[model samples]
Target: MQSTDVTQRFLFDNADARGQLVSLELAYREVLAKHDYPEPIRALLGEMLAASVLLSTAIKFDGLLILQARSSGPLSTLMVECSSDQELRGIARYADDITGDDLTDLMPDGVLAITIDPDDGQRYQGIVPLEGGTLAGALEGYFANSEQLPTQFRLVADGRVARGFMLQSLPPDRQTDPEQRAATWEHLSILANTLSAEELISLDNQTVLRRLYHEEDIRLFDSGPVIFKCSCSAERSGNAIVSLGREDALALLDERGGEVAVDCQFCNASYRFDRDALEELFEAAEERARGLH
Candidate 1:
């Protein structure tokens, strides 16, 4: 079992299907260390993080891919974001008594939203009901309903390691025979279903693929590293405070004993601003406003 974090992309030479395998060890540990999340929430967040990376690899965007789940049960919200550069961050909000193991038990009447935010273009979001027993099932349902494609996902996380595997059918243009395509997809999906949770979290990408598809000719591409990185900063946090208007910012500053602090939910990093810093930030914001006018 390698300790490095990586995502590998591969294709079946004999079928019109492509896949991605992601293993997260250090990144998983870093994310878990940021907060004292309960066992179930930690596992859920790990799955969401791995799923975000796996889904992001399928797109050609230059920004972020976010996986968000909101519900009316004990687990209120779970959010994970993975950038095109493979940087990832995630957080979850839940009640103190949340002890459910199944997705429905934790997030009853939940909705899963997948958002693609490109750096240069309009953002796209797809929403679907979280209907499956597990996170992987909900994601597969999303692909079937929204993308009109057959997709399969297997995700496992035990607080120490998080791993995910995704297999998606290619577009119709890629295959001439529809029956053959369907057969190939079913065959590969059945083989993938045989993967155990322990193997997914413990084995390397090459060994996993070989064990799953030993009879097939698969083309494995270069692997990319996945890192745990929070995009929050003092400047961004200050801008957020500036959005609250001058009077409100000043009131917060005064309430906090001359310093306002903003804590990032993902990484728990604190950004503080004193009265002088707030004044300077507001002055610069006003200057930008005047320039716009």
Candidate 2:
């Protein structure tokens, strides 16, 4: 909220549950900087962006955490990506005027999915029904049913900023004192939920921490920085074109004036490739297949 994306982890000295608080500002603004989105769509992006960071708090992954939603309404797609380092990026696609309401109102029957892709492993996905009133409640239900952990989330997005907090219970074996763990989780959840939009978007990370946990023995960990970044490049675009098959690519490129133009839908960045580029891609694909054999 202090003009930056900051992720902080906190532990309760005498409790079995842990928590994380993540706030955003500059990165959130950067997400909307490249295009002119409608007011409602922008706010929806903020909500999804905040929820992604909050979900990443308790996830143990070293690569990417992608949150996506594809709906049937005028607002079609929304996506937010977070890395182990808390770096984040997001964008939304929707009509200019999208009924003007909250997330549930806009996306009534869509599915919210979170994909965790580790540094060197298979990707795992979890789907959550977008039934509840707020995105926060929907994710809380997700944790309870899928992860089997009592989790609480507080997501706040406004003023072109996105932020959230999460409290997760440890494994039962570690939570020998069930009452204490429950008490600690409730204490933190209440404080986190009471956070104001100003506190989430205007104050620094530590200030927010102190304001929320000053009376408790909450231990703070190393701070992680987050930013808005889309991993789109010319090489990736070329690979995608190659996957489309050389004949089709060549035909399309020929129709488009001897060059292929591809746009990265997430960041709205354009990549252009002339005939030579496609030739090179096909050649490389062939060489890779041969080497594999």
Candidate 3:
């Protein structure tokens, strides 16, 4: 049976390569239900969500992996983040008349940014031009130009379900033959290229691997669950209000009829602050600042 909202890692025993397969069902639906997105934007958002999960698995950091597409076109920005624990959240900002299925049409002259923020270390970010017509192609270009690794990605999403498969070549081991390693990577990539969108979305991990690399020695690992989790909270919202300064917060509250409402873009959760709550928050912030001084 197929598992929904899970990511599976696999390795080739005979080649210096690794891959990740991801399928998102409930989590995808949860994100879409938060807002009404056009078909093109929804599909692009779904692909980015799936890509974030797949890319996160390859990183050894203990924080978050964020994928962002920014452009001046109809689709202004699409952001997706995946935590180390496999939690995911995403949002898309686009114009109302976003039409066309091509990435270039939606995000013309855009840039793709991949950021890795570790829990306790320096952050790293890479930017690549969105030259290709597809998100997968842009990602492949990122790897080629920045990481210099031979990578391939197959992403498919139909709003209800999002699926992704990633194949990357590992650096040749000291003991491995360089020519043979190259040959193995080339062969595996050729087979992976034959995968279709229908098979990736409908088939299980094991079945998909078998269909693609039935002749190769592949080791599939246990699957990990991916959940739709928002890292927003009342405390965080309060802190944001505090950053606005006490006077501005109070003025905004007064202008809004004594309540300031903040809505999270990722989950659409609303946090409202009235006079009393704002006063308490500002007082606490002042006390903390005093203590620091």
Candidate 4:
């Protein structure tokens, strides 16, 4: 059996290609436990969570990778974030009594946005129309249009387990031959296309790769854990309260029976602040401001 809640990277020694496999068990259950989402919402959120981790490993960033889907249909919003360290969290908002299974039926005019937020640099976002009726298909369009890379994604979820596989063509610095590159890419994609959702979700990483690329030279690396960890903290929440400014914050606190409450939508974690706590937060903020001057 495959290791639960981990991502493993692989490379093709014979071709300029690379891939990663992600399996989410405990982490996915943790996210689902936070919200009572509909069946479709749960499944889509699982896929998004798997996708975020897979994308995070492919990118060379030391921050967060966020995948968000928004629409006006039954499934209104879905968001998943994965950090460089493989911490994951996700949430979904949808209408009740949702019966639709296809993306077009659930999110008719939806848009998928992939945002890269680096720890010490500017942020970048790419938006793509939700096409091909599946998250995998829409992401393929995102790569085809925005990144111009030959990439393939296999994402599957059954509300209990979420798993994803990604195959991408590396830059042609070593291959340098267009025809050979195309041939190698086509070969890998053809083999990957033969992979069934059931097989990908059920098989172990070594078994899956052996079944698909038994004849190819591939290297599998050590796996890293993927966990469900909310980035929200009392300090961040305190900063948000301070962002409201002193007078308004105090007035809001007074209206809320001398205490203010904050609930994180992602993890359902609650943070509360009384008048004294609020005063201290603002004082610290002011002191920091004065020090900066």
Best prediction by lDDT: 4
| Cα TM-score of candidate 3 | 0.96
lDDT score of residue 153 within candidate 3: 93
Candidate 4 error regions (>4 Å): 1-3
| Model 1: lDDT to the true structure | 0.91
Between candidates 1 and 2, the lDDT winner: 1
lDDT of 3 by residue, 1-293 (tens): 64589999999887789999999999999999988998888888999999999889877789999999999999999999999998999999988777767788988899999999999999999999988688899999999888888999999999899999999998876318878888888889899999999999998899999999999888999999999998999999999999999889899998999899999988989999999999999889889989998
Candidate 2, poorest ten consecutive residues by summed lDDT? 172-181
RMSD of 1: 1.6
Candidate 4 lDDT by residue in tens digits, 1-293? 75589999999987899999999999999999998887877888999999999999988999999999999998899999999999999998888767698788999999999999999999999999999999999998999888889899999999999999999989986588999999889999999999999998899999999999999999999999999999999999999999999999999999999999989999999999999999999999999999999
TM-score, predicted candidate 1 vs. hidden true structure: 0.95
- lDDT score at residue 291, model 1, on the 0-100 scale: 100
Clash totals in order: 0, 0, 0, 0
Evaluated against the true structure, the overall lDDT of model 3 is 0.91
lDDT of 2 by residue, 1-293 (tens): 34367778888776677788777778888888877887777777887887787777688778999999877877778888988777778878777667847777778777888899999999999998777867778888889999888888777776467778777777755457768767767787788777776776677667877888788777889877777888899889989999999899999998999989989877889999999989999999999999998
For candidate 2, report its TM-score: 0.91
Which ten residues in a row are the worst by lDDT in model 4?
Answer: 94-103
Q: What is the lDDT of residue 53 in candidate 2?
A: 75
